[model samples]
Target: MAATLLFLFVFLSLYGSASCRLLQTPLLDHATTDPIDATQLPTSVEASPAQVQEVANVSRRELGYYTTSCETGNPIDDCWRCNANWESNRKKLAECAIGFGRDAVGGRDGEYYIVTDASDDDPVSPKPGTLRHAVIQSEPLWIIFDSDMNIVLKEELLMNSYKTIDGRGHEVHISHGPCITVQFVSNIIIHGIHVHDCKPAGNAMVRSSPTHYGYRTISDGDGISLFGARDVWVDHVSFARCTDGLFDAIMGSTAITVSNSFFTQHDKVMLLSHSDDYMADKTMQATIAFNHFGEGLVQRMPRCRHGFFEIVNNDYTHWEMYAIGGSADPTINSRGNRYTAPTNPFAKDVTMRMDTPESQWQSWDWHSEGDLFVNGAFFIPSGAGASSNYGKAASIGPKSSSLVGTMTANAGVLMCKAGSPC
Candidate 1:
C-alpha cells in the first residue's frame, strides 16, 4: 500500500512540472519573436547592424543633428557614410539617387534648386496656366521653386499617404492665399523650407466656413499649418516675416512633432489652437523640442490654444514680447524650456502676483491650470526683486531643474544680430 501511494505522489509531481514547462514555452516564444524585417518596416529603419543593436539609435538620429558633410558642401551620400547616422544616410540616398534636390535649397549637396519663373508649371503635371488647385492629389512629389516664385493656391496642399514635400531649403517659398488649407493627410513631412507672407482671406471671428472663414481671413495666415493631419513631422524649417503665427496645428492633428526649427517676425511663433466650437477628442499629443525663437523682430512667443503638448529643450532670446502664452488646462505639459529677456520689469510681477506663484515661474501656465507635469530651467529677469534673479530655478523633478543655466543664456551676438536691440 505504501509503495503504491509513493508512486501516485511521484506521478502527480511529474504532471505538474510538465504543465509548468508548457506555460513557460509561450512566454519564451513571445520573448523570442522574429526580428523585424528591414524591408517590411518604414524607411526610418536602417538595414545596418549598428541600428539593430541600439533601439534608441533610430530616434536619436531623427532628432536634429548636423553631419560634417552637410557643412562641407560634399555629396550627401558621402556625408552619410562619414556621419554614421541614419538620418544623414537616408538624406544622402534621397538626394543622390532619388534626385530630390539634396544639394540645393537647404539640402547637403545644394543641387536641384527651384526656379522662380511664374510661367513654369508643376513638374509632375503641367497645367495650361499656373498650377492652382484647392486640393492636392499626389504623393511623394518634390516641388522646388526659386526664391522669387511663390506657389499660391486657393485651398489646401492636400497630400495622400507617404507623401513628402522637400523645400530644399529657403530657396522655395509657397504662399497659400487666404483660402489655402489642408485636411485628412498622414505620414507627411515638410522640412528644410522657409514659408511666410501668406494671408487668410476671411474673418478670424468665424470659427469654420464652407467657403470662407478663419483661415480665409488674410490676417489668419499660418506659415506651416496642419489641420486634421496625423503622424506628421515638421523639422529644420524656418518661418520668418509672416503676418500671423509661424507654425500652427489645429483641428485634430495627432501624433505631430515640430523640432529643430526657427521662428521669428510673427505675432505668435507656434500655436496649437483648440477653440471652443472646434472640439477635438483629447487623444492628440504633440512634441515641440530644441527650437530657437526670436531674431525675427517679432512679438508674442508661442500660444498653445489647447492640447497635450510636451515643450522641451528650447532657447528663447529677445522675445520682444511675452516669451510664452496659452490657455491654462490639464492637457499641456511644458518642460525644459529656457526663456531670456533683458528688460522684464514684470518678471517679479509674474513671479509674485499670480494666485499660484510657483506655476507663474514656468514659461507657460499649463501646470498651474492642472497639467500632469511642468518644470525646467528658467532664467529669472535681471531686475526682479527676487534676490536670486539670475538662477531661481524650479521644476517638478530635481533632474529636470538640473538642466537649467547649463543650456540657457542671454542671446549672444549671433542671435541678437546688428541693429537689433539686445
Candidate 2:
C-alpha cells in the first residue's frame, strides 16, 4: 500500500503541482477504488449478488445527502435534484450517478469556484472567477455560476480533471459560441446548464490548464466533447440547435453516464466512438438513463461504435430519424425506455447499423428489454438475444416504462427558486 501511494504521488507530480490535492482523494488510493473495476457498476437487467451490487435498497431520499426537507419527486429525481436545500448541498449531486459512472465523485471534495464572470474573453489566461479559469485550476473544484447569465465563449472551454460544473440555483446557459471540450481528463460532472448554438472556433493556441499551453485544431461545434477521458457524468442539461452532436464521447473515453438530462433540436445527438477502427474504444462502457430525448432530433441518438452501453428508462418523444444507431461491434442493452415515434413512417426503426452489411451486423449484440414503444415505433433486435452478455437478471431494476413520463417530467435545466424544491 505504501509503494502504491508513493507511485501515485510521483505520477500526479508529473501533471503539475496538484500532487497534494490528488493524494487527498481516497479513490486514488488504489486499494479502495480499482480503476478497471470502477466502471463495472450493476446494470438494470442484471439481478444477482455476483452480477453487481444491489444498492437499490438505498432509498433515493436517503442517498440524496440533503440537509433540509426533501420534496417528493419520482424515485430518480428524488435522488438529488428535488431537494429544496440542493444549493447548500450541491456537491452531493456527485453521488447521484449510477451504472458505469457511479464512482465519479466530481469535485465534491474541493472548494467551490463560483463563476462571477460569464465572459470567456481569453482562453490562455482566463480571469479569476471565470468558468474557463475555474475549469483549468489544478485543484478539484465545484464550479457554479453566481447569477443567472448566458455565456458566449470566445473559445472552446477546455476542462481539467476532477471538476464539477453544478449549475443549480441559477439559470446558466453556455450558448452561441464554442462549447465544452473534455480531453484526456477524468472525473467530471456537468449538470443543469443550457448548451446550444455552439459555433466552432480553434486553429490557434489555447491553454487547457494553468500549467500547460498547446495549439489546437478547428473544433467541431459540439455541445460537449469527451476524448480519452474517464468517469464523466453529464446530467440535467438542455441541448438544442448545436452545430454537431449534443454530446460526443470518443477516443477511449470510458466510465460515463448521460442521465436525467434532455436533448432536442440537434442532428447526431450523440456519438460514442470517433472511428470504427479505433480499437481502444472496445473497452468503453457507458450508461444512458432517465433522460428525455425531445423534439426536433434527427439521428444518432447515440450512434455508437465498440462499447458496452446500458441504456435505461429514457423518454424518447421525438425523432425525425432513428432513435439509436451504431456501427462497429457495439453492445447495446436498451432496457425500460419509452420510445414514442414520430409521424414519419419511414423512420420508425430504432436501430440503424450504418455502413455495415446486414449479414455482418446481424451478429452484433443489440437487445431491447422492457421498452415501451408507441406510435408504431419498434426496435430491430439482432444477435443471439444478447441475454447472456448482460450477465444475469436484475430483480431490482429500472422502473416501469409507464412511469417514464412522471419520472423524466422535469427533464432539462429546471427552474430553481430559493426556499423551494427545484
Candidate 3:
C-alpha cells in the first residue's frame, strides 16, 4: 500500500502538469478554442486491481495529510470546495462547472427554495416545502434540503426550468420510488443526492409547472431522465439499483455534464442518445468527467448515438462487460481516464461498437489518448485519416490519468457540514 501510494505521487508529479484539450464538435464551440473537424481523425492503436487500490491509497493519503485545506487536483472541486463558508455561498458552485456544460447557470440568478417536507403524497398539487413542489415552480430556484430525508415519489417528479437541486450539507436520499425527470426544460443542476432503487410509475396526472397539470404515460424508472433538455448538470450523486438506466439523456438533450458521481449494481449505466434514427440528436453534446464507475456494473457506461462526447479523467474500477459502448457513429474522445478491467477474459475490451459491422463502424471517430489500462485491458480505436488539430485545441484540459485516483477519490454524495468545506 505504501509503495503504491508513493508511486502515485511520483506519477502525478510527472504527468499532471499538462492540460489536454477537450474534444468538441462543430456545433459546440464554447468548449474548445481550436476545434477539429469530426470527419478527420487518427487511426487505431491498441492500449488493474492494484490500480484501484492505488486510487484508494492515494485518497487516504490526501485525507490524512490535508485536513485543513482540500486539493484533489479536480478543477471543479478546487474552485469552491476549500471555502469554509460554502453553505452560505452555495451559489458559487453554479459557476464552477467545466466542459460542455460549462455555461449551465442553474438557478444562479434565482432565490433559495428550502425543502422542508419530504412527502410526495400528491404529484399534482404538491405540498409546499416538499421537493416536488419546489421543482414544479416555474420561477428559478436554488433548492436545498432542511434535513436528511428519504423521499418516495408517488410519480416521476417532473422538473421545471432553471432549478438547482443542491443536496449538500444534508443526507438526502430519493429512492424506492419514481425518481426525477427533466423533459423540455433547461438549466438544471442536481448535486450530492443518493438516488437508487427507482421503479416505474405514471399513468396519472402530474404537474410539471405551477399552473399546468397533465397526464403522463409510464416512465422508464431511471434515476434521472433528461429528455429534450439543455444545459443540465448532475454532480456528486450516487446511483444504484435503478430499474432502467441510472442516467439517461435522450431526445436531443445537449450541453450536459455528469461529474464526480459514483455508480454501482446497475446495467446500462448511461444512455446518451434517443435512438439510431433520431436525426435531431446530432446536436447532442456531453461531458462525462471526474466520475467513478465502481463495482457490479455491466455495459454501456454510456451507449451513444449521433453526438460528440468527451469522456475524460474518470476512474473506471469495475465492469462486467465493456466500459464504453456506442453505435451510429458518435464522435468519442476518451482521454486521461483509468480503466481496471474485470477478471472475465471475454470482457477485457473497454470499447464496444454495438450492433454495427466493422465495415460500417470502422469510420467512427473514437480516439483514445493518455488513458491507463490495468489487468490486460485494451481499447480498439477506429477513425478515418489523422490530423494535427488535436494538438492545437485549447481549453481547460483534462488532468493526467496518473492523478485520476486522487481526483475521483470522493466521487459519490459528499458529506458536508454547515460551516465546513464540503
Candidate 4:
C-alpha cells in the first residue's frame, strides 16, 4: 500500500485549447437575458470519507522527500517517475491527487481503454481506441496511448464523467486541434498531455456521451474549458501559445485544482468565474500551487471573481501586467509565492482589481503572506489580513516558496522514460 500510494503522488502533481476565439469571453457578456437566473449551477462537493483518507494516505508519505533529483526527491517524484516499474503500474497515478480536486478519481473502476487511433473521424460513431471514443463511453476508464501520438480533433472534445487521460509512458500531444470541453460533469482527471495550438471547432453535431448527440455552436478555442463542472483536476500539463484562455473555470465550477504545470507565451493565462456579476461563482474554490508561470505571460495567472481561492507556492517568474487579479469581491489567500516581475515598472503590481474603486475593493478579503518579490514586484493586499476569511482554502497551505524550485522543477509534461522513472 505504501508503494502504491507514493506512485500516485508524483503523477497527481502538475498541471488547453484554442480559438473559438471571439466567443470565449465571460458568460455574463452573452447572458442574452439574465445568466444570473440560472439557479441550477453546482456547488462544492465534499469528497467521500474514503476519498479523504486516500489523499491522507499520500500526504503521510510526502513528508519524507523534497529534492529535485529523483534519487532523493519527494514522494511527488517517487509516485511515478523514479519507479522503474512504471509501465506496469501506470494507473496508480489516477489515485494520487490532493486538494478539493482530489475527488476526481478518473476512470478508476473501469477497464483500460487504449487509444490505438488518433484520428477524430466520426463523432457520431467514433472509432474504438480513439480518444473521442474513450471519453464518450459511459463507463469509467483508464485511457492510455499505445505509442507517441499527435492528435488533432475535428471539434471540441466533450468528455463524460469518470475518466483519466494518463500520458505518463509516452509522448502525447493533442495540439492544433479542438481542445477539451468539460461541462456539468464530475470526477475527471487530465494529466501529462501536451495541449497547445488549439483552434476553434463548432457549428456541427458532436458527441458528449455514447447515448447523446448534440449540436455545438462555434467555440472559443480554449485549451480546456470547464463550465459548471465539479470535481475536476488538471495536472502536469504544459501550456504554450493558444488562441484563447489557457485554463478557465466558469459558471459555478467548484472543487477544482491546477497544480505543477508550466505556462508560457500566453496572454490572459487563467480565468476563474464567468464574470464580475456571476454571483453563483461565489462558491468557487481552487488550489493553484507549485506551478511555474514562465516567460511571456502578461497577466491573470488567474484573474478571479467572487469565490474563495488559495494561490499558494506558485513560482511567478514572468508577467507584464500583473499576476493575480479579480473583481466582485474575491477572497484570495496568497502565500509563500516567488514573484519575479519583468522590467516594466509600470506593471509591477502583482494584483489587479479591475475597475472597482479603491474604497469598495479595499474591503475585499485579499492577503499575501511569505511571498518573495523580485525586480520591484509587490502584491497589493487588502481587507483584513485575517486567516479567518480564507474558508475552505486548502487545509494544507502550500509549502514555502523556498522549495518552489524543487516542487516545480519538473513542471509541464514530464518526459516518460521507459522502464525507468520519468
Candidate 5:
C-alpha cells in the first residue's frame, strides 16, 4: 500500500522533529511552604525515561486518531476555533497544544499583558492591573483580560516562567480567594478561566518574580496547584467548589495537558501524585484531554500516584466515588472516554485501586482501550505492561467512543466572539 503509506509518512516526519532535552534538573529541595524561599525554580527541567519515551512518541503522532473534519471535531478545537481572527490571533492560542503538553510555549516568546486590575490588594506589592500583577512578571507573558473579572486572591497566586493566562474574550474568574500556584518554573498556559471557589490562602508574603519575594505557608486549596511544574497547559477551564484539588499536579509535575476543562462540585476531582513515597512522582507525565466530568464529582478523575497517565477524550457524566483512581504504581491509559454511571450500586466500578491491594495492584499498568460504558458502567483493567510500557501510556491515540460527545461539546469556558467562529 505505497510502502505502507511511505512508512507512515516517514514516521510522522521523525516524530515531529523530535526535541525535548532538559537536564539541569533539581526539585523538592525545600518549599515546605517556603522556608527561606529557594523553592526550587531555577529553570526546572526533568524529563528522562528516554525523554518520556520521546515525548510519548511525539504525543502519539500529534494527538492521534483524528480522521479529518475540522471546526470542532476537536483537534484541539480544530487548531484555533476556525478563527475569524481569534481576537487578533491571541498568540494563536499558543499554537494549539496537544498531548504531553506539546511543549507548552505559553507566552509564545512574550508580549501582551492586559488584565486591568481585579484586585488582590497586595500579595507583596502586586498592583499593576492585578491578577497578581499579571502573574508576577519576569518576562514572557500573554495574559489578556480587561473585561469580565472576579479575581480574588490574598495569597497563593505565585506563578512565573513563560506564562499565558489568556482568558479568552472575558468572563474570567479566579474565584473566592487564594488559588493558582504553579511552583517551580516552566512554560505554562491556563486558558479561558473560571477556576472555582478555592480557599486556603497562604500564611503571608508571596510574589514569584520581577525579583522574587517569599515567606509563605498554609496552602492546600488547589484550583490549579502544580508544584515543581514542567511545560504545562490547561485549556478551556472551569471547575466548581474546590477547597482543594480541582486540578493538582504535584511535586514533580511533568509535561502536562488538561484540556477543554470543566469539572463539577468536586471532591478531589484531579490529583496526579506526589505522595506514596514522593520519589519525585516518578517523573510524572499527564494528558487528560477533552475533559467534562460534570455534576457533583467525588472521586479523582485523576488520582494517579507515580508516572504516566493519558486518559483521553473524557466526558464521564458524573461520579460519586469511582471514575478512575490509582495509587503508587500509576500508569493508567484509558482511551476515548465516556463513562456515565452513578446510581450508586456501590458506584458501578470505574476503577479505583486506591489503597492498593489486588494482590499488589495486579501488577499495576491499567489500560482500557476504546472506553464507552454507559449506565451500569464498568472498567477494572490492570497491568498490560510492556509494549515498551505501552509506549509510555500511549500519550494519545484513540477517538472512537462515539466521538466522545462531539469531542466534549465545547467542554468549558469558550464563549469566544470577536468576529465569530469560536
Candidate 6:
C-alpha cells in the first residue's frame, strides 16, 4: 500500500513541474499575445488608465515639453513662448517631422510671421491667386514697419488664428480707414505700435441702435478693435488723438492683459463693452496694470461686464467724465492708482455718480450690488470741500493712509529707471 502511494505522489509532482515549466516558457505562454498596432487600437484602449498614468508620471523636463530647445525646428518659432535662436529654425524641425515618421498634423506651428518692409508703397498684401493667402497661413506673423516708410492704410489686416502684429521701433499711421481689426482669432499680441487718426468710412449712422449704436458711428474708428478674440496681450503701445476709443476690446473677449501703454486724446480712451445678445457671461478675467490713462478732452470711460479686473498702479489725470466705469458685475480690485488733475482746470476726483440724480445711487452703483472689490487705494477729491461731502465717502476712502508700499504706484518709472522686475 505504501509503495503504491509513493508512485502516485511522484506522478502528481512530475505533472505539476511540467505545467509550471510550460507557463514559464515565453513560447508556451498563452498570456503573452502579439504586439499591438498602436494605430489600430481603439481610442478607449489607447487611453487606458494605466497608459494615462504612465504618461502623467513623465516629467516635463524628460518629455522636453517646456524646454526652450523644443520650440525650435518648427515651421514658425513662437518667440513669445521662448527666447532662443533655435526658435528661428522651427521650420526645419517641422520639415523633419513630416519627412520622417512623425505625424504631419502634430508638426504644425502657430499662425503668423514677421514681414519686413523698409520702403513706402511696398504692398504687404498676399500674392495673386491668394486673395487672403496670408490669412490662412498657419503661422503667427508681424510686419516691422521700418522708420523710413509710412503705412497709409492698414485696414482689413484681419489677423485670424494665433497671430500678432508687432511694430518694431517704427511709426504706423492709419489715417484713412480702420487701423487694425482682429476678428475670429485667439491668442494675439500687439505691441510697440503707434496708431492714429483712423476715420470710419461707410454706414456710420445707419447702424445706430441703443445697444449697438456706438459700434458703427464714424467716430467708432479705433486703433485696435479686438472682436471675438481671446487671450490677447497689448503692451508698450501708444494711441494718441483717435476719433473713437483708443483701444476697444469688446464682444465677450476674455483673458486680456493690457500693460505699459500710453493712451490720450480720444472720446473713449479704452471702452470695453458687453451689449445684449452677446452670449458671453459678464464673468471674464482681465488685467489692466501700469497704464497711463489721461489727457483726453472728451469722455474717457472703461466699461466692464461680469469680470474680475485688476486696475492697479495706473496714473489717471484729466478726463471729462468718470475715470473708470464698472456698470457690469465687475469685481474691480483697484489698488494704487494715482488720480491727478491739472492745476488750472482742476477736475473732480474719481466718483461713482449716476447720470440721473433722481435714480437711487445704490441701484446704479455696481459696487453696492456686491461685485466691486477695492483694497489699498487713494481718492483725491475734485474740490477741497467736495471730498468730505461725497456720499459713501467712508466706503470709497483708502484703507491705509500711507501710499508707500501699499499700491503699485509709478510702476513704469520703477521698470524704466531702476530696471525692477515687472
**Full candidate order by TM-score, most accurate first:** 3, 4, 2, 6, 1, 5
- List model 2 lDDT by residue over 70-137, tens digit each: 32223445666566687788887776676677678889889999899988777898899899999999
| TM-score attained by model 3 | 0.86
Cα-based lDDT for every prediction = 0.40, 0.76, 0.81, 0.75, 0.75, 0.42
Distance from true location, Cα of 301 in model 1, Å: 3.7
Which regions in candidate 3 have their CA more than 4 angstroms from the true location?
1-69, 385-396
Tell me the tens digit of each residue's lDDT in model 1 across 1-422.
Answer: 99999998888787765544333322111111122121221211112222111221122222221221122111222223234343323344333211111112122233332334444233224243332211232323333433435666444333444444454422445655532244556655555555666665443333221232333333366666767867666655666655566777778776666655666566567766555346582445665644566554334345554455545445454454455554433134344444443244443111121232445435432421111111121322212322221121111111121122222221111111122211
TM-score of each: 0.51, 0.82, 0.86, 0.82, 0.34, 0.53
Model 3 lDDT tens row, 1-422: 99999998887787553311111101111223234343333322222455343543133224332223376668788888989899999999998887777788888999999999999998989999999999999889999999999999999999999999999998999999999999999999999999999999989999999889999999999999999999999999999999999999999999898999988889989999999999998878888988989887898787889888888778887888899999988888887788777879998899999889999988888878778887777888888525332332112466656666667778888888978788
Per-residue lDDT of candidate 5, residues 351-378 (tens digit): 8987767999888888776676765678
Model 4 per-residue lDDT tens digits across residues 1-422: 99888776654552112222112321211001111111222221222223211121122113222322463222344455667777788777765566667678889889888989989988777888899999998999989999999999998999999998988778889889789999999989899998888888889999999889999998888898899999998988988777888898999999887877888889989999999878889899887876778888888899999998887667787888999999999888777677776778798788999999999998998877666666667888889755466655543344444444446666788777777667
Give the worst 10-residue stretch by lDDT in candidate 6: 368-377
* Best prediction by TM-score: 3
List the candidate 1 regions with Cα displacement exceeding 4 Å: 1-135, 140-161, 175-180, 202-219, 296-300, 328-330, 347-422
For model 3, what is the error of residue 144's alpha carbon versus the real structure, in angstroms, after optimal superposition? Answer: 0.6
- Order candidates by lDDT, high to low: 3, 2, 5, 4, 6, 1
Ranking 5 against 6 by lDDT, winner: 5
Report backbone clashes per prediction: 21, 4, 1, 24, 1, 16
